[model samples]
Target: MSPLPRFGRIADGPPAPAGGGESFATLLAAGGARVERIASLAQADPPGAWYDQPGDEFVLLLQGAARLGFAGGEERALAPGDWVVIPAGCRHRVAWTDPARETLWLAVHLPPIAGRGAIADQ
Candidate 1:
């Protein structure tokens, strides 16, 4: 069998199904860490819902726009090139994403308990 291609484009994934929120594909996973390519099309977290993930997430906005909400009522708007480091166990949600076009994101997820310190050490 041929080896997996080492180079790929973030926009190569298929779009989300109609009204199907976001789409994600694992690009790489190794040593307790995984990288993913996420695509959003006018998606937002349901009202009052929050994602309390077990692993930390580092996300980079590649195209379009988005808004993120935190548990303490803090919010941030992201544009192309903007990135955020969300600590594990942090309550957060995607408040909004542009509906006019597909929004792309590059996300990195690390194992539980291997949070901020692991990031700093790398």
Candidate 2:
């Protein structure tokens, strides 16, 4: 037996953030892996704030544009169709996002692999 199919649109639910914030929608979850849709509108992390996750994150820019900043001072600009895999323990933060329009992102959180701190190319 298998689970039933699930369908959804990233923009189907939740309006853009009012004022300044981000909206998250969980699309799937199995075991320790999860998929999410993140909608951002004129939102960014507070100064000096960084996200250091215990697991790896694969993110794709679905719509709009944004920039990511790393703890080492490297910044990467993202546009539609752009994707990046952030390894566990990598300090990062959202530096900028399209403020005039909604910025949509598809993020996949991968279960942490013991003894590995980075993701290798397949």
Candidate 3:
């Protein structure tokens, strides 16, 4: 058959896993970058928790809405078509997500870009 159709709906997936823990599925990986589909069902970082990733991450909010809190004490709200980049070594957390709807996200992870600053800082 021809190359597998690289196609599917972003929101296509079984209902968010029970317990509402955010679910992440990698869709592609190549060289030094990868893509994923993340679904968050009314979830937020655990009490006082944060993420300190080893690589940079760029995420686009495709459905519902979300709030991202950075270690620098700033919280950014994201809506459909909105995107943000978290530079490697940056500390951040999911502050909130629309609990009444399914929050769908397309996320890309890549090796740190030399001398790049957190997109939220600009």
Best by TM-score: 2
How do all models score by TM-score?
Answer: 0.85, 0.93, 0.83
User: For each candidate, what is the lDDT?
Assistant: 0.87, 0.90, 0.83
Model 1 lDDT, residue 13, Cα? 85
* Clash list (residue pairs), candidate 1: none
Compute the lDDT for candidate 3.
0.83
Task: Kindly list the per-residue Cα lDDT of model 3 for residues 33-90, writing each as its tens digit.
Answer: 8998998878898756988887889999998899999887899999999998888888
Cα misplacement distance, residue 49 of candidate 2 (Å): 0.5
- Candidate 1 stretches with Cα past 4 Å from truth are 1-5, 114-122
Q: Model 1's lDDT to the true fold? A: 0.87
Candidate No. with top lDDT? 2
Distance from true location, Cα of 21 in model 1, Å: 1.2
Ranking the candidates on TM-score from highest down gives: 2, 1, 3
